[model samples]
Target chain A: MIWVNTIVQGILLGGLYALFAAGLSLVFGIMRLVNLAHGDLIVLGAYLILLLVTLLGLSPFVAVLVAAPAMFALGWALQRYMLNRVLGDDILPPLLVTFGLSIVLQNALLEGFSADSQRLPTAGLASASIELGAINVGVLPLMTLVTAVLVIVVLNQIFYRTRLGRAFRATSDDAVTASLMGIKPANIFAVATGIAMIIVTIAALYLGTRANFDPSVGPARLIYAFEAVIIGGLGSLWGTLLGGIIIGLAQTLGAAINPEWQILSGHIAFLLVLLVRPRGLFPRAVD
Target chain B: MTLINASSHRVEIATSASRLAAIAGFVIVVLLFAAPAFVSRRLLQDLFFILTMLGLAQCWNLLAGYGGLVSIGQQAFVGIGAYALFGTSILLGVNPVPAILIGGVVAALLAIPTAFFAFRLAGAYFAIGTWVIAEIVRLLVAQWKMLGGGTGTSLPNSIRREFWFTETIQDLFGVRAAASRDILAYWLALILVLSVIGGIYWLLRSRRGLALSAVRDNLQAARSVGVDALRMRWFVFISAAFGTGMIGALIYMQKARISPDAAFSVQDWTAYVIFIVVIGGIGTIEGPIIGVLVFFILQALLADFGSWYLMILGVIGIAVMLFAPRGLWGLFSDRTGIQLFPIRRRLVRPMISNDKREG
Candidate 1:
């Protein structure tokens, strides 16, 4: 019974990890960019939400709504102006540039927020939990899981059913050809990054509410997100969820056995998966 | 038909400017070696810091610049090396000096498994994969109770005071115990920087260096020419790991304290090294040398500002990446065509003989 409870909780935690990875997968699928500042950007989103909540005296959910559009614009401008210029044959420039951006964001946040860990002021949802027979699960984790599913579903619909999605696909397939076809690859990239930022804001809502976070936490989040993307196979959104679940399960199980092994177990699981499947469990056929 | 071959054939490795630079460099090194005799203890410590960082920057440049592997997880090797030094000395009672060497060897050995896993990913994935591996190593190290787990451990005082050169430095230079240790560590750092620079320069001049450049430029073309691209990359990666390990071990030995977090700090070891390389020049040997100087200057100027210092560095790094990807030294080298350490093979023939033959 205890083991079952741990597994169930792990699955729920996986949902948050999936949310963390969704934006990363979306951007990578379109632009082939592995933003080193990605984790920092998520932290940035959380801060934006925190700011909205603190200043406007808004609820956490309402603050996310306010933060999302603002984050979208920031991502769009960042992509169009800074990141877009660095994307090319050489991989080092984008990687190094984003690394610098990560440092900038981290330190700027540190200066602004004073390195003190902050949590979004939740009324009571953060502490609320539900009983399901033998297992009791936190309401926030359940909502996060549900939101993660909805996000992935909506993302898939966008990829398959929307015009902009086609442009994203077209641009990703071959930017030169897409540009000749009047797609404006740069604009498509900006839009993609903007959408990814919106997803990041959603993830932030949960992250800020669920745990205390400071500026330096970005890289650790990035590691988890990167691991999810890799395990799920690059360019596959649904795969990211499964990858996240696997990691979440590993962590909880490891913690059950020995609490100190929780984080290490996730990494060990990642390494094991990498060893077995070098291209990830479900690598995109085209890539 | 008997061909009258009168043209003298020679391949010049260095230009006249480079020769002069080499002579000047030798003089500067000699003066630096004599610095403990006259310089302030604080200044020596700073120079020691600069030299170790320079060594790290050079090794990273060799991997990312020439080998085409942009790794952000080099802290894995650094941490592992430091930990290995502490473990061997503490557990096995090995002498601290030899333990440093053992740390390097262990790091190199560890790189084999690391490269095995990291090599599976291409480009940016590979970078993150190495980072995850580093995190794993850190977490695992933190579990070892003997090493103080996550809290970390310090070198024994007996080992610190009784190390090989402590007495020799005190006897030779007549400095105090702590100052003598600093001078000894400083000398080691100096030796490390010189060897790494010299070694990388020599490697870049070899036939393998040609292949490395070829692979970096175009991997497909290199493979088409039977260059064995993967082999070249593996060689460079392993060699870099070895050199980086030695430097990491030496760094912690000087500190005499080893903590998992401090040992595996990406900000201190990897990020700053990357900044130095990108702002100096990624693919050139001279870039890190210039980059380290700029970094030292910035550190000296901005050390008082706390987080603002790092923010400024980040902003400068981004701006430099955007505006000048080749770095400050690269810009200068482009305009003046002066290579302080020239390695490009130049074919030369006696001008008169060649002209006569052509005529």
Candidate 2:
């Protein structure tokens, strides 16, 4: 029964991991850019929510509603103005630029908030749990799982069912061809990054409410997100969700054996996955 | 009448301008070696840090500049080397100096598996794969209780007193044991930096160096030309690991302490090195040297500002990447064409003598 409960909890934790990884997957699927600052941007979104929660006395969820658009705008501007110039055949420019951006964001956050950990006041939501047969689950984790699914569903809809989605796919396939078809690759990229930032804002809501975060925590989160994305395979959103579950299960089971092995177990699982399937479990045929 | 022309050949590695700079560089290195004689202990220690950082930046540049492997997880080698030093000396009671070499071998061995995993991923994924591997190594090391586990351990007094040069250094400098230890560490650091820089320059001048740049410029093009890109990459990766491992060991030895976090700190070891290399010039040999000086100057000027100092560094790094991607040295070299450590081969034939004379 305990093992069953642990597995169930791990599944819920996977939902949050998926949320952390969704935007990264989205951006990579389109531009082929692996944003080193993705995790830091998520942290920045969390800080935005924190600001609204404290200064305006808004609930974390409501704070996300306000912060999402702001982040979207910032993302669009960042892509159109700065990142676009560095995107091309050479990979180092984008990678190094994002790395520098990551450092800049983390240090700026630290300078603003100090190194002290901060969390959103969850109003008892964090500890609230319900009995499901033989196991108990936290409300926050369950909500996080639902949100992750809904976000993926909506993203899939946008990717496959809309004109903007066509532009995104067309540009991703061949930007020059897309341009010939009157699709501006730059604008498409800006929109894609903006959407990714919105998802980042959603992830931030759960992250801030569920856990304490300091400026330096970005890189660790980035590792988890990267592991999840790689495990699922690049360009596959559903695979990212599964990757998150696998990591979450490994971490939980390892913790069940010994607390010290929890993080190591997740990393080992990631390595094992890489060794077995270098291209990931569900690699996109295009890239 | 028959006329014969006599030919003269010059195989000079440097131009006259760079030849002058080389002389100056040699003089500076000699002065640095004699630093213990007149410099304060604190200045010596600071120089040790700078030299170590300079070596690390060079190794990273070799991998990224010529080899095209932009790794963000070099701390893996650093941590492994540091712990290997501790393990070899404390557990096996090996001599500390030789143990540092052993640490290099251990790190290189570990890097083999790391390359196997990371090489599977292309472009950006490869970068993150290295980081994940580094974190895994750090976590695994933290669990090893023999080396003080999570808390960390300091070098034993016995081992500290037993360094071969400690006695000699103390006798020669006529200083306290602590001061003498610092002097020895400083000299070791100086040697390490010189060898790392010289070795890199020599490698760049070799034929294999041209192959490395070919591979970096275009994998398929190089492969089509029978360059064997993978072999070159493997060579660069393994050599980088070896050098980085030795650097890590020497660094921990200087501090006389080994902790997982300190040894594997992405901020201290990787990020700063990346910043230095990028802001100096990525592919050029002189870039990291120029980068480190800029780094030290910034650090000296703003280190007191705490987080703000870091923010300033972050800001400068981003600004440089966005505006001056070639870095300060790259910009300067582009305009002046003066290379202190010139590697590119140039054919210089003093205006083929137009006048023919019979001797």
Candidate 3:
């Protein structure tokens, strides 16, 4: 019964990991960019939401509504002015630039927010749990999983069901040919990044509410997201969810045996998955 | 002008600037070596920092700038190497000096498995994969309770007192044990920097160097031309790990303390090194030397500002990548084709013209 409970909790935790990775997957799928600053940007969104909640006395839920659009604009401007300029044949510039951005964002957040950990002011929702058969699950965690599924569903709709989705697919397939057909790869990239940032804002809401976060934790978050993306396959959204669950399960099971091995177990599980399926369990793109 | 043989074309690797640099380099190295004799211990320590960083930057340059391996998890090697040094010295009762070598070996051995996993991913994914491996290593090292587990441990006082060359330096310089250790560490750093720089230069000027750069530029093209791209990657990867591990061990040995956090710090070990390489120039021998000096100056000036200093460094690094993609040295070299350590081979045509006969 306890083991079953742990497994349930693990699957719930996987929802947050999947949320962390969904934005990363979207950006990578369209642009083939592994934003080193993706995790930092998520933290930045959390900080933004935290600011709105504190300054205006709005609920964390409402604060995200306000922060999401602002984050989208920031992402659009970032991609347009910075990332697009460095995206070409050579991979070094984009990688280094984002790496620098990661450091800069982390430091800026530290300078502004101090080194102390901060959490979203969750009123009772954080502690509220409901009985589900044999296991009790936190309301926030359950909500997080639902939100992740919804985000993926909406993103998939935008990716496949819209005219803009056609442009995205065309540009991703061949930028030159897409350009010949009057699609602006640059604008598409910017919009994609902006949408990714909105997803980041959503992830931030759960991240801030669920646990305490400091500036330094961004990199660890990045590793977790990266592992999920890799384990799920390069461009597969559903694979990312499964990847997140595997990692979450590994962590919980490892912690059950020995608390110190929690994080290590997740990394080892990632390596083991890679050993068995180097292309990930559900690779979408051939690359 | 005298007539020369028409078929006397020869390949040239040396330029006037490089020849001049060679002489200047000798003088500078000799001065650096003699500095401990008269220089204050404080200055020696600073120099030590610059030299070790320069060494690490060069190792990274070889991996990323030349081999196109763009690893962001180099701290893996550094941390593992440092821990290996600590584990051997403390547990196996080995001397710290030779223990440093063992650290390099261990780190290189570890790279085989790291590469096995990381190579599965391409380009940007490879960078993240390597970082995951580094994190894994850090967590595992932290679990070694014998090494003080998470809190970390310090080298024994006896180890420091009996460290190689420390007694010799203490007697010769008539300095305190601490100052003698500083001097010895500084000398080791000096030697490491020299060898790293010299070895990289030598490798760059060799046939294999051509292949390595070929692999970096276009892997498929290089393979088409019969260059063993995979072999080159493995060779560069393992060599870099070995050098980085040695530097890591040496650094911790000098500090005489080891914590998994400090040893595996990406900001200190990897981020700073990456910035130095990016700011100096990525693909040239002159880049890291120039970069290390610039980085030292910047750190000296802005280090008091704490996180702000890092923000500034980050901003500068981004600006450099965007505006001066080749780095400060690359920008300068572009304006004036002066290569102080020239690696590009040129075909020097015969002085006498036989154009009519050839035509």
Question: Using Cα atoms with residue i matched to residue i, what is each candidate's TM-score against the true structure?
Answer: 0.98, 0.97, 0.98
lDDT by residue (B54-143, candidate 2, tens digit) is 989999999988899999989999899989999999999997888888888999999999999999989888899999999999998998
Cα error, candidate 1, residue A183 (Å) = 0.7
* Tens-digit per-residue lDDT, A181-267, candidate 3: 999999999999999999999999999999999898888888899899999998889899888888888999899999999999999
Off by over 4 Å in 3: B1-6, B353-359
Who is ahead in TM-score, 1 or 2?
Answer: 1
Best by DockQ: 3
Second chain TM-score, each model? 0.96, 0.95, 0.96
Local error of candidate 2 at A124, Å?
A: 1.9
Cα lDDT listed for each candidate: 0.91, 0.90, 0.92
Cα lDDT for residue A270, candidate 3: 98
**For residues B1-359, could you state the per-residue lDDT of candidate 3 as single tens digits?**
45456568898999999899899989998999999998998999999999999989999999999999999999999999989999999888899888988989999999999999999889989999999999899998898999999999999997777788888888899999999989988988888778888888888899999999899999889999999999999999999999999989999999999999999999999999999999999998889988999999998999799999999999999999999999999999999999998989998996645774465
Models sorted by lDDT, best on top: 3, 1, 2
Clashes of each: 0, 0, 0
The residue ranges of model 2 lying beyond 4 angstroms of the native Cα positions read B1-13, B356-359
Q: lDDT (0-100) at residue B134 of candidate 3? A: 91
Query: For all the models shown, what interface RMSD does each have?
Result: 0.5, 1.0, 0.6
Inter-residue clash pairs, candidate 2:
none
Cα lDDT of model 1 by residue, A172-211, tens digit: 9999999998999889999999999999999999999999
What is residue B207's positional error in candidate 1, in angstroms? 0.9
Which residue pairs collide in model 1, if any? none
